[model samples]
Target chain A: MCSMKVVVCVKQIPDPAGNLRLDQASHNLVREGKLILDESDSYGVEMGLQLAEQAGGGEVTLVSMAPNSETSGLRTALAMGAANAILVSDPALGGTDALGTAKILAAAIKRAEPDLILAATESSDGYTGTVPVQVAELLGLPSVTFSKKVTVAGDKVIVERQTELGYDEVEVGLPALVTVTAGVVEPRYPSFKGIMAAKSKPVEELSVADLGLDTSEVGTAGSRQQVVSVVPAEARSAGEIVTDDGEGFQHILAYLERIKVI
Target chain B: MTLNVIWVVVDRTGDKVATVSLELLSKARQLATTVEAVTWGDPSQIAEVVGAHGAQTMHSVGDLGGGLPGPAVGAAIADQVRSGSSPDAIFIPQTYNGRDIAGRLSARLDRPVLTNIVDVEESGSGLITEHAIFGGTEVLRASFTAAGPGLFVIRAKSFAAEPGTDGAATTDNWNVPDLASTGAAKIISSHVEESEGPKLDEAPVVVSGGRGLGDAASYQLIENVAKLLKGAAGASRAIVDAGWVPYSHQVGQTGKTVKPTVYIACGISGATQHMVGMKNSKNIIAINKDQEAPIFSIADLGIVGDVKKVLPQLIEALEKRN
Candidate 1:
């Protein structure tokens, strides 16, 4: 039986279904509301768990960086069968950008010492889509992003990375980072028994200092960029509305002709 | 201009420069006195187009063979920066390889990258990037508080591609620096999926479907309508997530942003994420049974009807007209 230890990076985000509020002072999405497992990260967690199960006697560890030492999202991943979790939370990490976040995750991930790392291509909230690769570079490891399908042999990870035209088959050795695209695997819901067990699973919490990172290199002070201002975008005005009445085609045709697209 | 020089990382297929790259070059010209290009492939073939788009020089990282270009290209640029030759800011299109290269460069240089940017402007104080949030309802403007060489990853079609009076760009080749372990990932093989008609993002007209179309089988109606109009077929994130269509066909924040002359969203309820990508289309036409669908908010013309019935009539009518 193949034994592969995988570390999955998860993010706790404001529920997409609920109203989203930005922190006025920082211009960051306010996470004061009870944060939940970002829907995007669930796919990575599920993929990691599946890969571990396929490898027989292996474990999938969770790594997250959030404020208020958020463990609610970690519990969900644990309930989905992650063995343990590492949480890196500190007030100093408030204004961290993609690069700072990557530094924190890379440091926390090193403690897991896994054979592979999995993360969503982009988080639902920030959506910079650069953190995973940044983590890979900070750790000095190879990475493949936008992976739709992933498999592991004895010492190599094979990924089918999504591209504009199609997909590319990529191969890298063990201890590599991979960013999974959404819908790669259907994430399973947490079962009652699994949920109960997750409450007792070990959750190791670390601070910015705990991860051997200096405050000068993280948070608002450490950030190389900042939000200057935010303004409402110019709204697109709505035009004509009509019931189909078996005549909707005529309107579309008229618009097409007016635009000279025909 | 606020910035002295700016570099646009060109993404290309063979000799043809990607439209987004030209768009960035055009914007870069407006932001800086000098605009240059950095690309992975040989620059000799694409110098003309990039130059016409306002790039004065094309910096090539040489051919990467089958290996991924992220590590090599990023490393090469970092080396240049360290050697005292770097642009004030770099503009990279938010493509698969583009993000990878930007990420590597950010990590290597310990800089931050602003991504998902839909607009960029000079704020006098510095460069500001505008991001469309909440489905383009709000714009968040951000800038680099630190000094030198800011990295920006912009979405496709964020800026128009306009050719300047420049001729062919002078080409400069940079050797791919040794990447060691960082260059381990290699492309073993690539499969290009079969696509029909005009490319989705470049099509003058786009026809997209959502979950309201019922099942995977019903998606063909979107394709048929697109073909009838000589356009391209697209899908909302809902349908793509439901496995009704491939992710390539998805149009949303996490998908390809298309600013076609006309966008036809059929049976889509207009999720915020979906609208962020296509809401900027010159003309939007939404067809959904639910009249209150958020898609109607930005639609130039809204049809409250069942796509199952409406799409067929539309298809038949278009065919008769042709």
Candidate 2:
């Protein structure tokens, strides 16, 4: 019914479709490749845009913690109609874990003074699935994760929180955080005109220092865990692959018998 | 390194403790000299089960008063650590509440959390955790470089849960601190989807369908095969996102992690996200129209066929055999 300032936590990750290379030294995904808006974050962007639109006023701002000052991903979201973006990029943020990332995002999000904060339940690449809640805890705000559906009513937000059994109707006062599940909404593709206009969208770049975070509080130095070893998981040996020869079910039946499940 | 004390976060609904909690307790017992358990509800309800799993002590924050348990419960545990009973590591099952509590605790303590753990061990007084990445293709072993009480959020079925002769755990009450605004979120109501047969994660056999099942009505084929097999029905995120099924049936990253004895994936083009959840199944069978679907890479038997045709034939054959 009024202005709804929603801040969406977006992640600029290496494209999943492309070859992924792990950094030999850091044991993290190599950032040398081009970065794109993580597909999971698009759902949150779309959800934020819709919520702001339904309220008839206000704007959606994007907050991201990325390497190499990646604005390419932010531009895509901005083109899709986010008003502006805040990017926290610093060499010191190379190996930030979920909690460390949360601290940085929470700092930037506070600057936006949003009524609601939205993020994907987890990033497509990292899949840590804990940042939004950690950010909420850091900001002293209540959080609801895995929201399949969200509604804003006055100063409170009602969410259909996805759970193991089904879903729970969760209600939290505004100025809270909610992590949207993937496919909660279809993200709109940037129109040609929108894309052209996005070139001028404001993307404010900041560093760890800008956020007043000490170097030892944000990155590899601040990371509590270190990769001890990396090894290939034991691969499942390939088995027989057959085209249906009108008796495919027989093979399944025989296999079941061999396994003695039938 | 042998840990002096390890704590397992027990998740329960009424009297039934989550299998993952017992699994963690078992693993914790092996790694530490002492294993403890914590929960949000009455510690007595799960005390015997947790004790049998090797938890020597149980802690509870009592009822959450309709509030989400994360903030209050997390703070309670943090208070215990601040007051002196600091465990070497805290093992949390990778469930909805587990992640929330772990995240809250990590934030409150200014520590980092290692999640998606598939295996954990103690080496030189610290804990090492293994995580499957890129759809279980690679495993990364990590260890906390910081201080005590390393928080680990582990996946289900990562370890065998065996019961000891221990009868009951010594119980203690943990204080729920003033949560301020963090405890304002409340579960106003809840719904549990009506499911028959075994739960998807607990079933010995699981039959899953994806978008290739055509329409919402075709999902019945998945349920039919699962029923005839005395298994559980699951779905890929694509169909669940398409609103064809409830989220309870989704088997994938961001969904349920299931390690059934046999997993039959029908009409599902295996994405890494989907595979992450079910790849650990003892045996995998994928039937997809596309031979190139990644599901075949791990499937013990790959059948390239239309699920519409193959499912009916399989269902009929199963019925006749029964």
Candidate 2 per-residue lDDT over residues A1-262, each given as its tens digit? 5999999999998898887768888898887767999988999999999999888789999999987888989999999999999999988899888888999999999999999999988888888988999999999999999899999888899999877677889999999999988778888999998899889999999999999988888778788789998899998877999999888988898988889888
**Model 1 misses residue A36 by how many Å?**
1.2
Instruction: List residue ranges in candidate 1 displaced over 4 A.
Output: none
Q: Per-candidate TM vs. native?
A: 0.97, 0.97
Candidate 1 lDDT by residue in tens digits, B1-322: 8989898899975357888999999999988999989997778888898999999998999878777878988999999988899889999999988999999999999888999998898888578889998888888988888787999999999899999788999998987778988999989998889898999999988999998899899999999999998899999988887778999999999998998989999999999989998998999999999989999999999999999998998888888888
Residue B140's lDDT in candidate 2: 91
Give the backbone clash total of model 1. 0
> Model 2: runs farther than 4 Å from truth?
none
Clashing pairs for model 1 are none
TM-score of each candidate's B chain against the true B chain: 0.97, 0.97
Q: Write the per-residue lDDT of candidate 1 for residues A1-262, one digit (tens) a residue.
A: 3788899999999888788878888788888868999888999999998888877768999999997988998999999999999999898989788898999999999999989999999988888899999999999999999999998777898899998778999999988999998888999999999999999999999999999999889888888888877888898988899999888878888888888877
